[model samples]
Target: MIEVIRSALPTRCLYSHVVVSGQTIGAVTRIRYDGPGVMVPRVFGSVFFYQPSQKINLCYGEITESATVNQFAEVIAEDLDALRDLGSGVWADTVVNPVRHVVEVGIQEW
Candidate 1:
């Protein structure tokens, strides 16, 4: 299952982790930026970790201006905690099982 949270900022950075069954399953950190005009959204960088004990996967993308790298790092830590909680719960219906490039979110012209 995949759970996603959208940011209200035009330039927002986020990090999260996924844990399953009381174990740390995965971790993700990303930064996303949205510029004015026709410019494409930018993803700064990301790092992820996937543990085999849990079937959950982690992903990160696009760094944002609102958070310094250090601040974002802190956010990432917090997200990991939240993800772990979410993953351990019975959230099969709250998460999404995504397809490849054929499917996506927040896109108008996919």
Candidate 2:
């Protein structure tokens, strides 16, 4: 089984973590900005991990300001330590995108 926890800054910023059983294996963070025109909602980050074989996958992307999608970019790590290192304060202004965006992170044992 997988458990997920999410937190957001008002409505523009979002952060989430995914845990398998009792171990944290994935996480996501995003920031959104207000623009003059109508923007399509999109996700810009992702995270995935497979414990059975110790496999990991991650991806990141950006969509046009007028485009929208059901999901967003994701990043994954091979282990808990790697995941923590990658997600460490990812929401920090020094690394996060300046534009409106969304991110998703997850981990699983299969």
Candidate 3:
């Protein structure tokens, strides 16, 4: 089963790294990103932008390394920047680790 490794920074990123991608998803959605890199803690982690609905809300990420993080004014600027970078920038900086074993039930929006 896919699980989140759990860490302070990643736990913080879940709530702090909120982005309005203006991308609307279907009733069922699975955002995915993968390649030869170490941005996220998993092969399937939050590597792109997402606009949150009232339905599902939770993310867990721990930063083992970062570049854009240090560039912003706020410490979370790292998370913010990393979350918005989409493909490469985020892949280069952050690590993708979600909450532990919640996918069994899954999250949904009404």
TM-score of 3: 0.16
Kindly report which residue stretches of model 2 are placed more than 4 angstroms away from their true locations once superposed.
Answer: 1-13, 16-77, 94-100
Error of 3 at 1 (Å): 23
lDDT of each residue in 39-89, candidate 2, tens digit only: 235333433333333222232333233323222223333453554454444
Which candidate number would show the highest lDDT if scored against the true structure? Answer: 2
TM-score order, best first, reads 2, 1, 3
Q: Judge candidate 2 at residue 71 and give its lDDT.
A: 28
Model 1: residues with Cα > 4 Å off, grouped in runs: 1-56, 59-75, 90-110
Evaluate model 1: give its TM-score. 0.20
Candidate 2 lDDT score at position 34 = 28
Candidate 1 lDDT trough over 10 residues, lowest sum: 101-110
Tens digits of per-residue lDDT for model 1, 26-103:
322242232222222222222222222211122232232332111121125435555445434323322344222221
Pairs in steric clash, model 2 = 33-100, 43-72, 44-73, 45-73, 45-74, 46-73, 46-74, 46-75, 58-76, 59-74
Note the Cα lDDT for every prediction shown.
0.26, 0.32, 0.25
By the lDDT metric, which is better: model 1 or model 2? 2
- Where is model 3 poorest over a 10-residue stretch in terms of lDDT? 66-75
Q: Which digits, one per residue and each the tens of the lDDT, describe model 3 over residues 1-110?
A: 01211111122222222333222111123323222223222211233222232112222234332322101011133354433333233233333443322112222211
Error of 1 at 27 (Å): 12
